[model samples]
Structure formats: C-alpha cells, structure tokens
Target: CLGVAIFKKKDSVEGTREVYKDQRGRILVVEFIYGGMNFRLINIYVPNIEVDRREILEELKGLVVGKCIIVGDFNIKCSRLDVGKGVKVRWEKSRGIGMLMEIMREKGLLDVWRYENPEKREFTRRQLKEGTLKQRLHDKSHAIFNAHLVSKAVL
Candidate 1:
C-alpha cells in the first residue's frame, strides 16, 4: 500500500480538498488554495510491472485536467537520457510511457527536474528492503507541474 500527502504552511494554504484517489492507494490528489488560485498536487505509486502501471496511468489521464500536477514513478524512462551511465537495462520499451508522455503533453505537466536540467544526467540511489539497484530511474519520484501554474504561483 502507498500513501501520499502534502504538508504546507498553515497560512499559505486554504480550501483544502481531495480530488481523486485509487482503491489500491496508488494515487492521491488534493487541491488547495495558494496564491489566490486553486492548485492540485497529485502523487502516485506506480507498480514496477508494466501492465499494472499502464492501467493506473489510463485511469489517471482523465483526471489530468486544469491547474494540476501529476507526480509519480510512472515506472518508465521518458528517454534514453533518463537512463544513467552504464544503465541500458533501465530503458523500458513500453507504450505506457508513450501514453504518459501524451498525457503530460495534453495537460502541460512538465517533470520539474527534467525540464530544468535537460543536459544533466542525475540519479538518486537508495536501498529498498528488497535491495539496491544503481542507475534505476523508477525509484526516483517525479514532480510534474503545470508550467503556467508554477509561474503564476510565484508569491
């Protein structure tokens, strides 16, 4: 089971509301008032398995409307660059990834880190209970935010 939440300064937010959540606890989305506009924070735990991951993404696509961000593992590599040095095994030749990219394109949600540092190859390494895998992209979480929404909430 996965859980997601956002902790913000008390005064900086208002009108907190939950937008969506999955039965398996895979996704959690909430809306709140910030900078005088409503913004959504979406967090998800994408399964490593390809088929399951794709199903979650499909259900999530419809919810990708308006002033929101979708953040999750997506369990995929957006491009070859997302794979680290000597990590060709990490590349997933899956259509689920393409669908995810399409969803992002339609909603204008950009992976914050990727958008900012296009030329840099960065990886966050850690040890899960199962084990540690170097140069793996899925373990790292993504913060996908609408570019327009980010710029407007500059308070």
Candidate 2:
C-alpha cells in the first residue's frame, strides 16, 4: 500500500479530495484543493522487472490537469541529470524515461529541484545492502502557471 498523510491548518477546509490506486497497489495518487488552488500528489513504487510502462504512463497522463504537482518514486533512470557518481549509465532513450519527459514537456511542468540546483548532485534513496545510491529526481515536478503568485519566500 502507498500510504499518504496530509496535514493542514485548523481552519482550513478542503475544496476537493481524491485518491487513486492501481490494482497491484503500486501507484497511489492523492488530489485535493486547498487555499483555492488544486494540488495533486502521486506516490509510485516501480519495480525493475515486469513493469508495463505504457499502462502506467497512460494512467498518469489521464490524471494531469491544469496547474498541479505530481510526485513519485519512479525506479527508472534518466540521463546525467539524474545520476551523481560512478560509471554513467545511459538512459536517455529508455521508454519509461521518455514517457516521463514527455509528460513534463506537454504539461509545462518543471522539476523544482533541478530548476533550483542545476549542477548539483543529490540522491533521494540509497541501497545500503548493495552500497549503491541512485540520484533519481523522482518527486519534484510542478506546474506553476501563476509566476507572480509564487514568491521566493514560499520556496
């Protein structure tokens, strides 16, 4: 199960709320509206083998709407933008990566962390048993249509 918890102010009232889950419980999407803005938060755990990338991508495409945030732990790798050290693994043409890039481009979504730190390297999760770390930019996509509404102080 993809467990999620949301916290808001005491006086806040949610305008909308929804949760989407896949049959295998691997993908979970939570959407809600607060402060007059809609927000979507997705949580995904993709295994390395036997994954139907096309189906997952189609499901994701169906969910994106207007200005929102989409986040998840995608196990696929991208190019150098997602790697830190060691031998560089090429993943530019991978189907999963390509699909993700397409979504970002079509929806005008920006990888918040990459946008803020262009040349920095960071890892979200580490495999302790294998002594391996992957610098995948999993949970950092956002569509901020109103630039003036977003202040540096909020970031």
Per-model tally of clashing residue pairs: 0, 0
Best by TM-score: 1
| TM-score, candidate number 2 | 0.67
* Top candidate when judged by lDDT against the true structure: 1
- Deviating ranges (above 4 Å) for candidate 1: 89-92, 126-133, 137-155
Deviating ranges (above 4 Å) for candidate 2:
1-13, 92-95, 126-155
The digit string of per-residue lDDT tens for model 1 on 13-33 reads: 889888888888888888887
The C-alpha lDDT values of all candidates are 0.62, 0.54
Q: TM-score each candidate.
A: 0.76, 0.67
What is the alpha-carbon RMSD of candidate 2 to the true structure? 6.0
Q: What C-alpha lDDT does candidate 1 achieve relative to the native structure?
A: 0.62
